[model samples]
Target: MRSDPALIGPLLERIAAWRAGHAGLFVLGVCGAQGSGKSTLVATLAERLTQAGVAVAALSLDDLYRTHAERQALAREVHPLLATRGVPGTHDVALGLATIAALERGEAAALPRFDKAADDRVPRGEWPHAPANAQVLLLEGWCLGAKPQDTAALAAPVNDLEAREDPDGVWRVHVNAALEADYQRLFARLDRLLLLAAPGWDVVAGWREQQEAELRQIGGARVMNPAGVARFIQHYERLTRHILSEMPTRADLTVRLGPNREVLELMPGA
Candidate 1:
């Protein structure tokens, strides 16, 4: 909760280390479970780097969500299981790849924005020329580099949720099937992947509940609630745990966070 810039010294050091070595499209991924403070860290890092005279571009993978209408339509026809997101297949991976590639190539484009409470995207304008050779691009998301778990690996309860949305639809199976390829495409562009580590899915449940409460106060009753929060957590359970395990073996850096989402320690990836 402390806003002291001094607390983030080590993370800044790690990023600076990366910048000292290369100049090619530096993709910095801020990975965490839902509400684990990944977005806050990305925003802070981007601001600090920009203040330091480093060109920075901040993007969220959440914004890559399929529009509400599109998701609703998919939920009704092809698979209602497709309605809730957080899984890899629910996103526009190819579009994400294209946008990052374009940005790296110095092309101008508008960034996408999504409202979690509304579960929809709002239109926006093009991000200007990336301050010339932008030194950093911060990508924050729940499962930025998460690999899909096999349908068999999912808990028995998740199978029920998947079935509820799309009876006779093999949504989970199809979703896991695409994991390897999408992450491959996403990781290929990464200069470094930084994970904001949580103790367990409990971190997700707790922070998500807090977020919903705050939203109710700010955005009113239309915002998410305990039931909706639980439903949203259901979408990520399988891969969420998998990523928590996988990132320690895969990421370049991991910042362990407490229940309050405060940085507890620095965990270097194997």
Candidate 2:
């Protein structure tokens, strides 16, 4: 249960190595399962880098979620599942691409932020601009470098949410298609992808429920109880499993986590 005191040190080393040869704007992805502390890792890294006089831009994939109105319209037009904000199809990938482009070009890019309590993006003017030429840009998300499942893989429902709600596979297919297209393009911009892999999906579920509990303690809005957490998590279960199995082999670095979020294994990807 004890955290690895040296976790950040080695990561900074690896990032320095990546930056050594990169031409400009080293985009490092801090990808992890839900409630697995991707944001904490990025924040810690940004602080460490800043202390050492490095410029960094910190962002989150959750920030790219489409507006609540946009998602509601999608739900009416596409499938009812499109109304949820966590899935791939719910994000505005074009905005993500454009923002990253502006940062890479040494132009001020307003980093987006989503108000999870309200389940919507905060106004654009409220977004703070990241100065140009940041030495490192950290974009963390649950699915930062994830890929779509095979079409054949989608034929079977992975959980009750898929079986009972999306029996025809339409909703899941739409998510995968988005992942294959725009998500991939956005992911391609990452100079390095660091995966924070949980022990398994069960652990991820526990982590998410714990998150909900903490949020509720603070009277956070739209907070779900454990049962609701279970149902809501099913929306992400399929791809969560896919990334846990697939990303370790390909991520620039993979940090396996214990049940308590302690670092268990750190493998440099092939």
Residue-wise C-alpha lDDT for candidate 1, range 1-270, written one tens digit per residue: 235453467788888888787866688888888888777778888887888888788888888888788888867875667787667667777767877877787655456677766777765553334455556788888888776666556434444455476354466666676677776688668878888788888778787788889988887756777888777677777677788887777788887777777777777877
Error of 1 at 81 (Å): 2.1
Which parts of model 1 are misplaced by more than 4 Å?
1-7, 124-130, 158-169
The backbone clash count of each candidate, in order, is 0, 0
TM-score of each: 0.88, 0.97
lDDT of 2 by residue, 153-233 (tens): 999998999999999999999999999999999999998999999999999999999999999999888899889999999
lDDT of each: 0.74, 0.90
Best candidate, TM-score: 2
Looking at model 2, residue 138 earns an lDDT score of: 94
